[model samples]
Target chain A: MNFDIAIVIAIEMNIKVQNISKSYNKIKAVDAVTFEVNSGELFGLIGPDGAGKTTIFRILTTLLMPDEGNATVAEYDVVADYKAIRSSVGYMPGKFSLYQDLTVEENLEFFATIFGTTLAENYALIADIYIQLEPFKDRRAGALSGGMKQKLALCCALIHAPKVLFLDEPTTGVDPVSRKEFWQMLKRLQLKGITILVSTPYMDEASLCDRIALIQKGKILKIDAPQVITANYEKLIYDIQSKNTHGLIHDLKNYSSHYSVYAFGEFIHYIDKNVDFKPEDLQQYLEEKNHSDIIIKKAETTIEDVFMDL
Target chain B: MVFETLQVSIIIMNKEKIIQVEKLTKTFGNFTAVKGITFDVYKGEIFGFLGANGAGKTTAMKMLIGISNPTSGKAIVAGLDVATQSDLVKMNIGYMSQKFSLYDDLTVNENITFFGGIYGLSRKQIKEKSIQLVEELEMQNVANNLVGALPLGWKQKLSFSVALLHEPKIVFLDEPTGGVDPITRRQFWEMIYTQAHKGTTIFVTTHYMDEAEYCDRVSIMVDGVIEALDTPKNLKQQFKVNSMNDVFLKLARNIE
Candidate 1:
């Protein structure tokens, strides 16, 4: 490539996808999805299972060929420059894929060796995580706990010091404390000028990302800054609770003029379709139905509410 | 004879103690997986067993389900001793693991039939219950489809329903909502609420703090010992935090 062309590519987006689609048989796994990740951005692919998050990750990593459209990682075509993309990106799959029989230190060493580097060469990149796994260095990967295995996998993925990181549901099944710590680690890595594309099913984790794309059933519902997406929810929501919680849901669903109703933790989230709907009227109605000790309050919309509305 | 009859009456009056444990402990070789933890699960109550990964929650759950033998102490689940009367305890309780328990290649109806048969259900009872299960989940369209073809949320709901087919006195859910979306998770909890309303004792373990709020009472295990046990509201107040997640962080912070 000429110097001018290389400069132009450098100015363009680090990760770009145009109308990428994939399918298994007649079922569409990822539909004409288009998105871009700017350089040094922490982008999130927020969606549930079977929403085609993995398919997009696979295409971007050059592991699977897309049936339609195209993608580029680090200004290199996923197909024409598959090897280049592979060397420039790190991928931590949802399932822990490390050698279970190998000790943590051995696993890290193996990955570093496969990348044609030693831990000493890129020790700084995985220093934060390695420190946590240091005590369990001699323990086999299979014998390690979920959080430890997660750290080990992340260490292996970062051993090569790729320019971009792709993590698919990195915190699923992990405890809340560890999940918070993992995101903190990601933030630290972001400061080091590495672009990241992470996917997760947890809605609360959306706020941690710089920007998020809510995908479902192979389509992108919305993509924007977390605050912007949440602020755009145009509904009057309420958090309601009573002695008979299940009956409260059943009654609200059947009650007249109510919008979406669903259980959220211990309380029920009810949306009023009519902008002028009053909480007192609903309270009166529930009281008539023998719901005592009822508590209802206007609630703020969250990323989950936006995703559900979409 | 009168004194003995009075003792039996006292035991019968405390029927709410569906699960009673006195310092349950389990050790794997030299490593203590579950320390001397004592707690009780009342009838028709949603009891949350919470902890971080490798916090001995799984080990404690295994002992209660009569799968793993305890090194010491005692546990009586559904009025049957877990150590000596494991078979009786097993017959009166249901279990749903974190991993997908149903066979992928099998159809939904077939999987239901298999589990129902394992619980010694008759053919007629299986048929009737299978129909009701499909109707309740609105899965009639996919009843004949392979379990593998269903989405993760649907599969999880199906797995939960299958676990309840036997109508055991207590149901143990080991992180039943792991990796599931928020909407589906809420729906699954609604199902749990319905089951609890119907008089089935629910014992569940999860790392999701929001889920911890849904339980009537929760116990937080750290390392091999339970660090805290109380209602979610009390726990938040005790830790001086606004959410259960913060409470968990405050507790786990002190541990190595």
Candidate 2:
């Protein structure tokens, strides 16, 4: 029985949280939050800024303690086994924390040395990302561009071959192209059997994760696969367009049946309160308001829509 | 009096160029940050300055706002030369950024009053403006509350309103809607529209492609150069892409 229990523990390397809560100055930062991450799963915590995402991250990484409840990472207690947890997990904070004055190569070497490892030992694990930074190895980290700096940070995080990786808002200010490239890198890392927990404010990134937890105001609104969350959205949204976008938004909000209206890309995403909403009805209303070049069609629901509705 | 009226009419008829730049360039040491970028912003136009990370957007913006001197170029902002009359240029423009703009320890009313005084408004004018500003934003309840205690969305809105206290001709916003909730982000854009409708030239920068679509015209920078500048619609049609995100990807990735 003892041997069997040991085997189960070895294979069940996952994260588990139960009713964890934290407060600051009597204001609840995280309130009874509970979730779990299976081994090798890419889990995402999606929310806007100041939604208690960073506090939860600090708690899980053993940098801070929860006021109540308990949690475990890699089958080790976060409070009792903090030393072990600290060695096994890699955490990249939302702010840049690397040594800015050191050269890129020096920063990498320093991190590797602290973990009692050498760059040669883990070259294969970070080969794909390090190649991009090879040319800038001699330059100071502060001199590197924003995208390059992020790549360097990720490389340092993986130097020890950590079992789980924690990334907070990695693409917050990155442009669309760099954001896309960053997601691709995460996908490749996940294929190597590393469990990843990432957070982002950009709602579109939720679809890229295996599973996501939509959080706001220190509470989880929903948790499920990205497809399931969007598929379960019950509202019928319409893509609205016209020559004068500003005027179109005002007119839609004034319509009697309008439930919600906001700009989405080039079109205004409109949701009607009526169950039997008709496209022709909205079309006629817009025409009467002198909106020309009108185009209305069924719009696909996204994570942003779900978040706003919640 | 007749001559003054005729001059004002002529300015209005000519489209009233609030900002005009010609081959603006800036360099530091051996690196050229902004390389001979040229563009014009008319009165009441919401011009989006976009680029990938470290694509010279910040550097270009600094020069245009008169804080950083250009290596070589000509930029006339509010009828003052940026390089020669930087102090005068600063007085004629309002600047705001997501990272820093408002003090955390000051109350909402204090911030408005403080910024009003710095803009050279008289004591009587500041008093009247503060009262009107507080009511306009519907923050009567939190007027005396410290800005640190407010939510992120509310702080952002209040910061925007404070920037407009002096009613400068042009407002420079650096990622104003970043990290705010969806509803608040739209509400912020509505404020922008209202300001533009009142003839305030808005020069803004953002990473959100959807926000780029709302600009009257956009300029995409790559490798310290303006690769594309046109209306979002025309750029999409030219690139044969469906959205501005695709247009940005094609442009940024192609250069890489």
Candidate 3:
């Protein structure tokens, strides 16, 4: 923790996405959305699939040219200084596209070579992470486990030690365990002062970031600390689980004050009229409606709620 | 040490022996994806294989289904040695790949017929099975549409139904529900529950922690090795972790 990797102290700490907008024919992918990421912060672009998370990422990483607005990464123009931006950023795309036929070590070496450096030159940078993959160094990249492949992709991304690291849903389909371990690895990488910008479809992962931007329908719904955004939630949430839980949605939607209700795995998350709602009142109401064993407890709002609200 | 803990647990679970793997390993060239780790899958139970990406779940599954040959050791699935009775094993087994294993260009009926024929089912049996599957999935309206145009969640449900077309003794799913809505994931599991009740052995692999908890028993792998094998509840209780994710994190740290 004490040793900083170059330590990247900056004079101007800011990123401005001024009136950025993009569309494909009539479909607006990014609709004049704008948000700034600090120089040394772990930020998240949290949203559902097709919510333009990938479009925003590609534009920021200088992969796709934006249609309407301007973007500046590390104070350099994304369009004019694309080469400078490319050399200074590390990106692990949502999909793993490394050479599948090559061994784990070979993949790392190939990535290092592409970045114009030898593994020996930057061995120290990746040693802590790479050593774990040493046992499978001889294993083909395609044959490495999901967790191992994730680690290998990460090592290659960090070989050049880019100033800003962009991870697009790095934990998309990885197991919960591997997903948890991967976050821990990101925290360690952050300790080295690497600015991280990650996108994910899972709302649960949003809480782990320093700050998150909840985007939906190609728009920025909200951007704040996970707790702050949740605290700002205006609707009252309840956990409505009971017999015929799947049928609860249609019945509840028939209620006059119900804001929204969506199934979230084991239980259903519901929003209702917050003005005069209480456990007993709702209980009696459901009872009158012939609902039995309804478990209606007030729930704190989550990032998913914010997106749903939008 | 997570790997060590998993290894110890798997050893104990194998004492009674539902699935017996003796030195089962898979390798290509100098690369070993699954390094000679043996275990067993119990009857009338849900067995889960948890691993990091490319950790060899797919390779191991391919071998168990008799599609790929093992590099060393031996595996007996449904009391039949995978090496000797490849066709016999296929007759008694159902498989679904991570890619959904469905032809996008083909209609639902076409896809069903294609697989049924491959499994050597009679024409009458295929027709009956197709009707039941379509009714169960509630996808009768889209039966004539190209499967490729369907959403991810719909495709997953259809794929699961298609896998069970012949009602084999066991069904194997490899991330069958990836990139689908959570609501869809729940419904897919419901279908799995109904099949398990009919005395079908279910073998699945997934990255979702919550999904792992649904398994009757599970084996965790690290570096092509089985680190832990136990029920989700038992593993969580033994590890003293709040969730399956923590248990996995604690175990993976040791391997790393």
True contacts kept of 1: 0.84
Q: TM-score of the candidate numbered 3?
A: 0.76
lDDT by residue (A18-136, candidate 2, tens digit) is 89999999889898999998888899999988888999999999999999989999988899999999899988999988999999999999999999999999999999999989988
RMSD of 3: 6.6
Error of 1 at B78 (Å): 1.3
Q: Write the per-residue lDDT of candidate 2 for residues B103-199, one digit (tens) a residue.
A: 9899999999899988888999999998998899999999999999988889888888888888899999999988888879989999998899999
Rank ordering of all candidates by TM-score, starting from the highest: 2, 1, 3
lDDT of 3 by residue, A1-310 (tens): 4335333354233456877878877888899989998877889998756678888878888898899889888887888988988888888988898899999888888988888988898887778888889988998988666677888999989888787888988888776666777788888888877788998867788999999998866888888999898888777788786555435655777777777777653356887766776667756776777777688877767776676666
Q: Candidate 1, A12: how far from true, in Å?
A: 7.5
Interface RMSD of 3: 3.6
DockQ for every model comes to 0.66, 0.71, 0.26
Evaluated at residue A226, the lDDT of candidate 2 is: 95
Ranking by lDDT: 2, 1, 3
Which candidate number maximizes DockQ?
2
Locate the minimum summed-lDDT window of 10 residues in model 3 chain B. Answer: B11-20
Tens-digit lDDT string for candidate 1 (A188-264): 99987788999998899999999999999999999999999989887878999897777899999988998889877
Reproduced native contacts, each prediction: 0.84, 0.81, 0.38
- Which number leads on TM-score? 2
lDDT of model 1, residue A243: 73
Candidate 1 lDDT over B1-256, as tens digits, reads 5795587457546758899989999988899888899988888889999988899988888899898999999999999999999988887898997685799999999999999999889999999999999999999999999999998889989999999998998999998988787888888988998899998999998877778888888999999898998778778888888888888998876343
After aligning candidate 2 to the native by TM-score, how far in Å is the CA of A184 from where it should be? 0.6
Higher-ranked by DockQ: 1 or 2 = 2
lDDT of 3 by residue, B1-256 (tens): 5896688577656544435688889988887888998877766677888876556777888898898999899998877889999889998888997565899999998999999999899999999998988887888999999998666678888888888888877899888766554556766776776687777888998777667766778888877888898877678888998667777777765443
Please give the C-alpha DockQ score of model 3: 0.26
